[model samples]
Target: MKQSSAKQYAFSDAEYEELRRIIEQSVGIALASGKRDLVYGRVSRRVRALGLSSFAEYLARLRKGDQAELEELVNAMTTNVTQFFRESHHFDYLRETFLPEMVQRHQRDRVIRIWSAGCSSGEEPYSIAVVMAEFLDAHPGWRAEIWATDVDGAILRQAEEGVYPMESLKDVSQERLRRFFLRGKGVNEGKVRVGKSLREIVQFQRVNLIQPWRIRQSFDAVFCRNVIIYFDRAHKKQVVEGFADHLAPKGHLFLGHSESLHGLTDRYQLIGKTIYRRRD
Candidate 1:
């Protein structure tokens, strides 16, 4: 069904379909037809921002290769819904089982690398940093690094700043809140900044998962939770295969609580809740 013709500049089904295709090709997120309203709500601002009259006019500009506008469109379309320690079980498994194994496997190198794909607003990577820091604090004598990437450059900048509202720490314990974050003051009251220790271990990058980027490092664990669920099956396979290529042999891949690889591929084995290890 098409959007109502009653309203001027109604986001028609054809325009929405075109937008969906472009977004999927660009970032692999298969926006649903149900997302028409969402797409319009977010993108109409873009049209108005360009002083354009209609959605058609804005999309025509996109067709003309306005690289900057394309980027902004993607950013606006991308959702950055996240919170600290969101799926707590994953962190539990990481702190208990995965980190120990990583440290043991890399005894000779004394280094561990983890990737936080789709990390938004710094929460996921910062949470991982807390786990890594506590492990290093107890075990000592090792370097652990995390590469956090997202498709949204605007959000990536916010992640790099390492700042968050104090309420985002509800799940964060007092010990961690004190150890890994610095409290804000006066003008900045009600917020906190990720402390130096966690920041030292996390490096931020803007990357489109389906597209190529020059990331030379391999990782022992990849936290791509909740990301691939937006992609179509083929793109999910492509993205997961790409992760497999970059992961160390037998390394772990963590998906969202609701995500799975059952029919996607045979590259991994389900070892725990939402956890898969690359097959040997």
Candidate 2:
């Protein structure tokens, strides 16, 4: 199939296969058969930016082990569609059921840890941070830490920056809007910065879920929402098992609305909508 316009470089089937291989091998995400146009649109820009004339040349450079180009390829292929409070029900559950129980369980230590796996552009972790901050504010002695991670370094930088357009905060309540964000001013008008307190509670890091995870700390809750859909069954199983391994006993795992652990593993029991609890 002709992948791009005549003015732009053509993407051959062989070149697509090579790009697909690199993406799957490096990130455990499988591009479906119909994603040729999408891949071409994202990757062709990279080819042009590097002054390459064709997808064949891009594939050749990749085959010769260009690590930087490989990084760019992964960044280009990875999808990051997220919003603040994307699934409001999950946050409601966290606020009403989970946080109270967690506070009681960790009363002595006064610490709670949550992981936002595949956190894109800081929204998920920031949402978690908002909830945690509300709880901690009410209970003065408690502390909460949120670790947000993703494979794409570029998007992680955006997350670390914690800046977003005003429209992105629409779902966020007026109350939260006033409490958690500072309205941008001057040349920064129409943007919002997450408050210092909320930002302080969340940390962003580059983590490829398919690779070996070096984090040793167990978490009370893990939000890997909407992430595993890109992976095939085997890789999905691997990532879920890894989440189970790192969760504290009876910890909760939240999947995306379209995702599930049915036939994947028995380490967790379904507790709520797209939510699972680690079996004791």
Candidate 2 pairs with clashing backbones: none
Each model's lDDT: 0.91, 0.92
lDDT of 2 by residue, 1-280 (tens): 5455564777777788878888999999999878988888999899999998888888989989998999898999889999999989999999999999998888678899999999989999999999889877889888899999998999999998899999999999999999999999999999999999899999899999999999889999999999999998999999999999999988999999999999999999998999999998
Candidate 2: 10-residue stretch with minimal lDDT: 1-10
Off by over 4 Å in 1: 5-8
lDDT of 1 at 80: 90
Against the hidden reference, what TM-scores do the models get? 0.97, 0.97
lDDT of 1 by residue, 1-280 (tens): 5775565467877899999999999999999878877888889889888888998899899999998998999899888999999999999999999988887789788889999999978899999999989988877789989999999999999999998999989999999888888999999999999999889899999889989868787899999999999999999999999999899988999999889998989999999999999997
- What lDDT would candidate 1 get against the real structure? 0.91
User: What is the clash count of model 2?
Assistant: 0
Q: What does the lDDT come to for candidate 2?
A: 0.92
